[model samples]
Target: MKTDRIMWGIVLLFIGGVLLLENFNIIEFYWGRVWRFWPIFLIIGGVNILFTKNKSQIAGIISIAILVITLGILFYKGQQPRQKEVTISSHTEESNDLDIPRDVTYSHPYTDSASVKTILNISGGGTSFDLKGSTDSLIIADVQRKLGNFSLETNKTDSITSVSFKMKGKSKWNMGEGGNDVDLKLNANPIWEVHMNMGAGEVDFDLSGFKVREFNFDGGAAALNIKFGDLLPITDVNIKTGVADVKINVPVASGCRIKTKTGLSSKDFTGFTKLEEGLYESPNYKTAVKKIFVNLDGGLSNFEVKRY
Candidate 1:
């Protein structure tokens, strides 16, 4: 059998097994956690291609076994009962290292002011998120939750700074309700790249007071409201969600264009001119000195865009 075919067969088998286990209540698999491991499949395919030639069925069988074992280990660990809840910090891969002493406020500043770029990665799994601009420091992150439920990670380099928020415990789908709550302030001086991955919650991002170069939001069954601030240094904004309701505000003076790709969803962009089926442009988009471009993709969602 061809290596590509063998690899795909193994992948299908693994997915089928996972679904079977899920059906039998033997394991509850979170695809988000396992999605990062996709690169391993490429490696497996490469190994199969190299070794499974000239009727070498042993190589293909070994490759399939390896994948099965890997997935088995993941499911086994996920099903283990922790002495306490397990929180995975975005800053580190080791989940057992989180030790939250009490229900206290935690703060971390950008250690070096010389860093020109800041990337804020907030994984607000089933939580409420509120973020705005701040001049108090390079970045200020504040998270409030039950003790031992969440943790923060900060990493700084000469050219970049990164901060992440991660949660612990059994997380359920957030359907417009509560989970981890976060309030963060970001410095205006450095170029900012903000990425949020959230689930079943509400997100309010008042970014009009900050200087942001790029922003990306990904959510699962959530509600998102964003207000753009003055001096948007970046031109591109991207958002993807599943079963979400979204509203966005763009500064009136900023020329803006919106392109939406969705499935069975509704959009209200009243003031903008529709250039095509799913593309829109502001009145001054061609003449304005600075412009904003937005791209959205999702399914069964509500989207609205307004000029403020």
Candidate 2:
């Protein structure tokens, strides 16, 4: 057999076997742990190039052995527990030193009438953001930061309110250092439209109690989980991501249509039927009163939509 063919076969088999084991719950692999070792691919390519002129059996065997050993190391490291970073808590003591990190709380009053429409804009990176429960105020944000600063601003126009929450400066990563964390709560009265831009981090939002009109997210190398309710006549969701894991939950009774433009990505739309290329629809799409439209565009990511 050709040496190139042998190398390609081994690569495919390793990837297939790892995915199979992950699907069967035999081993949990953390891709983040393996991401830093991406330079190994460059080394492998160099090795193959060096041996290209020599088509001897010994050269092929050496290449295969190196590949196997590199893969073995990655497999072992992926299953190991990640080291925990030191995190700052809200109750941490205050210090006179300016270098000490501190917790901050921010809120915007719910002064607008219930009939008003509200838009929330969020932008940040290297942080964990969560939205859950309802608050009497328009919005409440509690931030715990080890570096950088956060800002919240609100503006109201005729029949509409806009709230913006964002990190002010870039965050620098240090070894064994903690990251910023933000917890957010929103009022349930106003019809909401949420837009978020995240460079990298984790996001968990439960908008099941609010009347959400539209939701949008743009992120890179992040994990996102969102659950939506059937409180509105129609809900629109749009997401664009790169190298991320995204999961969305929708009500089973609500009709849903999904359209995706994904390149080198995996999708699991379990309860939806394919209507056409890049289009899927729930079974009750035609008859259901409440409907949801979802559009997803991603590169090298995993997308899953489940009914709850």
Candidate 3:
């Protein structure tokens, strides 16, 4: 067989095997760590080009062996836990504009006047953001960082309160040293609409105690884990991602529906019945009083929805 065809077959086999293992939960692969080694592809391509002109059997064997060895290394690394000591250095000249890093705590007092509806907007990248508990205050945020500037602003218009928390500048991420970490808590008194835009990082949010009407996330190359509660009659979640691992959990008692527009992505929806292409619903969807609707749009991602 031609070396080119052999190389293509090997690539396909590797990809298919990894996807199968990941979908079945037999192995957990971290794409984030593997992505950093993208230069391996370039090396493989250069070797193939150099040997293609020589049609000798030895040339083909050498090319195939190199491809297999490189893929093996990638497979092994992908299965390993992400190293906390990994550091991401920024090469952009704009890095000098970043502010001195500091640790800060912010709180916004809750008042009855703006309890009707609350909108929370978060924007940042290269950090970990988490929401775990409810707070008596309107919102509380604790930020620990080694770089970048963090700010929070709030405004009230009639009965709706809008809160915006964001990182102001770009900075290098030295995970071995320290990076931006934000822990957040929000009041459960008012109905909430949350929107988050992040370039990359990890997000773990538990909004089970809050009355969430709408939740939206737009991210790239990230790991996202979110659990939603049935505090409201209807909850809508919309997520758009690029190269991500997304896991969502919903209460088993609530009716849930999922609509996905994911291309070349692996999906596993446990305890869900397929109604049609790109649509799934829980068994109690038609009769349950409370319902959740999730919409996923992603590219090259792993998506899972589990009823808990």
Candidate that scores best on TM-score:
3
lDDT by residue (tens digit), candidate 3, 192-289:
99999877667899999889999999987677889999989999999999767899999999999999999977898988999999999999999999
Model 1: per-residue lDDT, tens digit, 82-107? Answer: 23233333433333433321223456
Leading candidate by lDDT = 3
Off by over 4 Å in 2: 1-24, 27-101, 171-177
Q: Stretches of candidate 3 above 4 Å error?
A: 1-16, 31-102, 171-179
- Per-model RMSD to reference: 11.5, 4.6, 5.1
Quote model 1's TM-score. Answer: 0.63
Residue clash pairs of candidate 3? none
- Candidate rank order under TM-score: 3, 2, 1
Q: Each model's TM-score, in the order given?
A: 0.63, 0.77, 0.77
The residue-by-residue lDDT of candidate 2 on 1-308, one tens digit each, is: 37767786786677556655765689886654554455677898889888877978899899989999999998998788556444444445354332455678889989777889999999877667889689999999987675567789988888889899988666421111245667899999999999998776668899999999999999776668899999999999999997677889999999999999988667889989998989999999999999999999998677889999
Query: Which 10-residue span in candidate 2 carries the lowest summed lDDT?
Result: 170-179
- Candidate 1: where is the Cα deviation over 4 Å? 1-102, 111-115, 132-135, 146-148, 172-178
Computed on alpha carbons, the lDDT of every model, listed in order, comes to 0.67, 0.80, 0.81
Candidate 1: residue pairs that collide? 174-200, 208-228, 208-229
